[model samples]
Target: MNTSELDLRELLSFKPRGGAISFLGQRMYLTDLFSHGLQQMELCRTLGPEITQSIIVRAGFSKGWLVAERIKRQMPDAWAEARKGKLGPLLCSMYGFGEVLSSQRRDGIQATPLVETYFISLYEAEQHLRMHGLSNVPVCWEQIGFASGYVSNLEGRTVYFIEDECQAKGDSYCHLRGNYLEKWGAEITPYLPVYSGICNETVAAQLADVLRSDEALPRNMQDKINLSLKLTSIEDGYPVSNSYAMRSLLEMAINVAKVPTSVLITGESGVGKEKLVQYIHKNSPRSDKPLVAINCGALNETLLENELFGHVRGAFTGADCSKSGLIEAADGGTLFLDEVAELSPATQVKLLRVLQEKEVRRLGDTETNHVDVRIISATNKSLEAAVEAGEFRQDLYYRLKVIELNIPPLRERTEDILPLSRYFLMKFNQELGKNHTGFHYKTADLLLSHNWPGNVRELVNAIERAVVLSAGPQIMPEDLPHEIRDTLCLPSVAGDIRALHEVEKDYILAVLEKLDNNKTQAAEKLGMSLATLYRKLKEYGALQIAICSWLYSIAAILPGV
Candidate 1:
């Protein structure tokens, strides 16, 4: 029961029956740190930082209290040992919060002692760096709350911890100074309500209600839809996706990542092909190695060749020194060939040789160097069409297309539009220092209705522009670009307005077609019962056609439909 003898294995237990994990005999679950950070960012976007911080802090406080109470009941000696100030930091490190570098107690003006602790390599700060980049304010709210709760319970009085310096705000280490309530009066008054718990409970209840409301996506669907891809750039991490299409695409990409085969990603420009490539590389075995990317379309034949195949000294005019190509640099890792379809025939031949032989020969050099790398190429253009047109090498096309991942356009995945918009809104709000709550209802309608020809990139630009130009608390219609705003203002041809039922029929049919005549899924997405969808289709004189299409689709899969 001694704190020094505590082991993590003894404190943690797993029960596979219900897929439950327990820490200190209390239910616990593991989660990805990056995903946790994205959730925190989302909470901040919806509830504002103050409320989100309160919620996280209160949750941490509750956890700390539970742990303390459990230890006091199971190991009274350990509870007594905690009063000497050795147990809290040891337990914190044991629980993977961070490593405590130093801890000390100092005499204060009041009767209560002041506890000062310094921690390094905390997970919260690391997650912030990965997701939101550098923050201006301290962001260890949960750790601060946990320390306060643990210490307060030991002290048998209200104690609070103030984060004097935090790694999230670019501090070298996190410094937490704690003391009894009266000892640090006035400076801690504003945060006292959070520790008092009543106000935060109300805010958390309101948040729960909002999450469970009819306007929100179903809880199970939300879990399935909340997918993210961590990126190299701190500011540009993942596009939040709510579409089944994107989810299935990502699942395929992950499965394809297990091997070292060449992959070709095809999609419209700005559809996040590069992001998908990054996701694959990150999940691959060579994740710890470099991921070097080059745009074949950005460079001419000569430059692209030199970039991909490097050169020896004096290989060309002004070539003073030998250099390794991106392919060479990416040895034991991944080389991302963006816009691979734009590679000239000569460059394509050279790239094909590299893929086939796993070696790259420098320009003006007879010898070739071996490279162990995975090739992940992306293109907005169709390589198959290019091969048919004799604009690209057929052999190279086959080599690159060992596995293909095609991202659907934004217009085709309407379910993800609003989620992506809100994600971009949150991102730019931090970058632009704005406090826009969300899109106006009318503005949201305009966004969902637009075709988004430029795809995800266009949405990012639009949201950034709206965040900058928005004058009200929420993004209004006027804040959007002219093209997006004019969507609602466009006039019908001949000034003829269609009947509401006719328009509804057209929309329902469009949804069914988009889903490949999958009526069950279409109904779920459209928020209608299957029976009601059938009735509507019958009224529109399309029920028989829908049934035939469904049967045809089934016939293509099964031996008999």
Candidate 2:
């Protein structure tokens, strides 16, 4: 029976496991993503297959119904991705947040009093999820995109299409053996309500079309990328991916608290090199004493020395009062020199004397003062290169590199993007009193795809900008600044083509594997012309392998198949 054109009121015989649940007027579901076969494998396979489930769940995104508003209002505390698309059972492991809605019926009549999206509470959402007793997608972002999508409004509608496809799977065999595809199962989820009433099918479809449009490129350009930013561990509330490394470095600094060795922290300009310096000071034994910090690159020789060491009365023109330098203030504590590489020769000599003699002679004074202080310096440049080029002193370079730590760029730690994104979201929301729940799923992908040249600093600035600009419960793609907007559309900027190709390849392979080698779906997702995809597949000789892999996987995961 062709149910597509019939009014839902005429035939209400459909029965999916978790009957249609909705929030407001948006329609969506909670799919039993894990068929009986996969459950058996997960229970039985040890290292046998950790990647399979992640792959299966990821296939949910290929056909999702994403609605930008309701998903945001319903799960204000959820990840941004969820707000835009209605995905399958959210893989919390890598779940970015979202809600699902589906139409429900109690009688034989298929027509509803009216199609509606239903509001669900946080507690109820939690309870409903708990009762399912199913695992979420893998924690990794790559895995989440594969395991299951954070489906929302339009994304949910797409999934219904997928459901249609899945139910139709056996139809092909019907021609040969007269066997029909069985209705495996189905489900429904809740949606959030908006003041302007529910999003109609037409508008929802239009929105989806826009989201998939290439014009979204203003947010994806490469040249406009900033190159400085620290990989911050915590800002608003989200934890960055390299939290472990940053923490380990802090612990190392603490371990050497008693030693007076100079510590050099190298990273991009805005990568929080200075912040890490502070972390070292706070963790060191000199925590009780004053800690002074100066940017060596920001001042001239005479001013720099006077800034680091005290000046005698009438020593210089601005010697209005005999004043103590930052060094004097941090007596018995620690002195942090930022951009230490920028220090001129004259300033370098004075700093070297302070470190070596543990004494300082105030300007124009014959007498010298003895002091004890630890020195912690930071620089974003390559000190070794500077030393070789005769720009920085050999002695100072030797001293600083004694204990060096290098901070990895954000692109190097893609796993952390979502976590840090959320951290910023929660923080800005609380600080500004906005009720933004999180990003749209596409936003998460956008962040991952971006080349954060400015590092951790850039993320903070972007989040702050987005927070101030947004007035709604969710941060839409438009909420992001032009830089991030361009990032999603442009090709990878931070890395070379090789890396980009690898990432793209992995994404395609993972999706294909998840869809059980469904060529049509895979082709749609590869964002390629079918001929191009087929030619490339033929060139790589991946066509046969992909099909074989998919069949084997399905045979292994499906029960009694």
Candidate 3:
């Protein structure tokens, strides 16, 4: 099985005698496999590379498991002999990967394969030649995974490969080194994503690794940790959050769901207020009934009134027939009135009556319809200001604000930027079918520095655009939108009036953001030791409240700061 002694004819002897080319009891046409591989490439391009890589590695692991079982049953002694630096290259070659030019066995526990003429490399090279810019990260994921799976199962341990040199990345050949899970701890943590699909470790462990490596120190690190716990504890379909501010709000929302009190959600547009509404309704006692939602701001006063309180025949100019309104439809459930601040003063009087009487009077109807419904309203504007300005009804506002939840904007919760970025990336990976692993260091820098005026919705759009336009693998700074990059790269001349300490703070934060908030990485990047970075972060109160609060305070006072 060793590359030096690999016998092609003998390896071919394992091929079954059948109509279609069969290898080790499995039959398939070369074209079929090749066609499937091509289809996977297309899916990767569409879905984002992260998902595609995960699927490929998982498929390779399953194949390796089957091969091990078959070989163990047919030739138990052969399995043991193959362990002496034989199985990896033999299986790799038989599966049409390439010739393993050489392999180094270490302590009979791990294997390193140096492959030439590899199929993955050849395919990538040809694709890049055709497209002129298709190449990015290593393209030989399945091959590397197959070797790791074969060895891991044979040795009864967790083993995986990291492709250090790849032809796709412009290397001449592919080089993969395998090791046990703990063997490369911390050193190969970034590459550990390759094992995510097959590793036996629980999700908590994986998440812990993310938080440890990419530290997002919030107002309190423990509070951030508590937020992570809340994130995992919530029911499905909730917008994933890592910021203490958001998570604390979610915790309150869940508690409020236990009561029948009216709730008003306030936040910036695109902050997922409707999602919060849905979460509250789904967790409430009325979850069995429909949860209706409407945007009051999108309708004229007449249309809004008709929509909320229903209309009988001939009630309005366009009324063709009688219809029940959103409130009646949500009789036993919850009605979410989004942008409730936009309700006209006249409409507000009607809403107040409905909230007070628990009955809705349909326009042109003689009798009011009694209903049991919990009201949940939301707005992106300040209802308080609206009340003071005499635009919103103070009585209705009080009725709606029985339990208020304010969702923090994205920029304020800077700790959430990376987590939300990954969440959206994964979402696009599944929805679009592109195989994107993650952002490049510089790209992360740009993401953190950009002042996101559009909040979470804007972040989602940016990630989607980047994923679609990015060539492959990691997203580089150039892959990002010009606005994001331009905003972050503002020129600073030597004559700039900023103080040295202020300049140092900005640079330190920039480095930390680029490094995904890892203090260690930030320290090294800034040519300072870990202690010094911690001391500086403590002094500036950046580490105390994460980064935004401190930075925003300075920016506000500095008049373009």
- What would the per-residue lDDT of candidate 2 be over residues 1-561, giving only the tens digit for each residue? 011111111111112233442222233443442453445356436534344433433332222223233333222223222322222233221122323223222221232211122222222123323444323311112222221222224233221111111101222110100000121122222111100122235435555444433211222211111112233454222245445665565566567666767778888877677766666676667778988888888988878888888788889776777777888788888888888889998878877888788888888777878888888888888988998999889997876678887767776765556677766766776788765555544455467668899988898888888778865444556678877875532223332233545446545654654455676887887777778777766664566555555566578779998
Worst 10 residues of 3 by lDDT: 220-229
RMSD over all Cα atoms, model 1: 22.5
| lDDT digits (tens) for residues 120-182 of candidate 3 | 333434444345454667666677667766776676676677777776677767777777766
The RMSD of every model to the true structure, in order and in angstroms, is 22.5, 18.8, 20.7
- Model 1, position 125: C-alpha lDDT score: 84
TM-score of 2: 0.52
Q: What is the C-alpha lDDT of each candidate?
A: 0.75, 0.51, 0.68
| Candidate 1 off by > 4 Å | 1-237, 489-561
| TM-score of predicted structure 3 | 0.49
Give the clash count for model 3: 14
Report model 1's TM-score to 2 decimal places.
Answer: 0.48
- Least well predicted 10-residue stretch by lDDT in candidate 1: 218-227
> Which numbered prediction scores highest in TM-score against the true structure?
2
The true-versus-predicted C-alpha distance at residue 360 of model 1, in Å, is 0.5
| Per-model TM-score versus the true fold | 0.48, 0.52, 0.49
